[model samples]
Target: MTGPTVSSPHEVTDLAAVTLLVHDRTRRVLGAFLGREQTVAGAARETGLDLRVVHRDVQALRRAGLLRVTREQARAGRPVKMYRAHADDLFVDARHLPQQAGEGQAAALDPLFHHAVAREFRRALSDFSPGWGLRVYATPDAPGFAVLEGPRSARRLSPLDEWQGPPARMLSGTPTAHLTTAQVTEVQRDLILLMRKVAEFSAANAGAGQPVLLRLGLAPLTEDELRNLHR
Candidate 1:
């Protein structure tokens, strides 16, 4: 489906712009560049924010352990402090424990709580996403997250489901491939959108039975495919 525009593999989008702006525009910018590299000017231009603002945001990200800054002097320009995302610290997701809410109680609030939580999740994920597809979260590990795929970037995917997975370095933002921030953002958005739908389904099925046991998880891939990332 048509979705947010993607400018760079690491561009911060306007999906949940307000919340992305929660830590100010710079953190949002940092969100776009999580797990990669950039500079104040490069980030500013990519994220469509101000250079000064990018600088401030980088500082904040550094404090939040979301960014790791280094220096580089390209060709002949003065040395510049380059920034890369620390990843784990930049963003987060949660588990779908649903509190157990007792046995029958689970079904009672399943509908309302599902909707409320889904709405909150979307609002949170849409903050910096672009175009991405859906992967339902039917597990305690990696539930309701998306793996973004698009053109012109690498680092392709982000988590939309509750954080906590099988330690897949790539999914955990270890830069397994040349995935882009845009891709990650898209994945995250798709995740949120999918969950939104799930919540809708839950709402429709209220008072039906057994609280609809939905487990969240990542799309299954093979060892060869994952290993291919190096190639």
Candidate 2:
């Protein structure tokens, strides 16, 4: 059986870093290092790219903090640097990031905020593939991952209301609200606290239950309709 794909959150902090990761050669170089450590020469061999090109691409990834220097081995007359991908996942929020760069409040928001949002977007896209299981939020309090069960598995599993002993709806609870900037900030603060509580509970019961897939997301809608609705 295939293993569950693991993803570690890595944020795109700037436009330049984003550009570098999306570049064809750099992306391949990063892919080659995922889940394993490799020397520059090994990466070049795996990618079937020129040694010089692989060296350059790896350097770029290293500069962007996307590659970790795993160790060093002396070969010939010099030490060879072994590197690995810093994260298995890259989360970029092109849709919600500020149009212009600045060092201010937006930068001060939880560094992982956009990363979580991007994970949710990724889950939505992955659901389009066949053989993928149905995605469902286990609980509103736990936002980081969703549970995925095949149709047969889903049938065996109890619904959320049955599992949690609460009335649940298949549809959303309420329409999106228009809030002031301060209100939005306050709401985010509450969400962070809730997520922390759920995380603590999850950690304490780490292996007590079956594994579930989840993607946490919280973002202000920027659609024209939403913007027009803002008070």
Number of the top lDDT candidate: 2
lDDT of 2 at 70: 91
Q: Give per-residue CA lDDT, model 2, range 1-231, as digits (tens).
A: 999987567777776667666566788988988888998889889899999999988888888888889999988988888899888777777753445433354565545545554565456445533333455755546575566543323344467533322221111222477789998888889878877886777899976864433324456787786768765
Task: Score candidate 2 by TM-score against the native.
Answer: 0.39
Instruction: For residue 116, give model 1's deviation from the true position in Å.
Output: 22
Task: Evaluate candidate 1 by giving its C-alpha RMSD to the native, one decimal.
Answer: 23.1
| Candidate 1 lDDT by residue in tens digits, 1-231 | 999984533333333322333444555686666656777788887888877877776776676555676667666666777777754232222232223324455566557656755554445445534422343333345554534232222343345432522221112223344446787677768878878897888788886744433433334346698878668
The clash number for model 1 is 23
lDDT of each: 0.54, 0.68
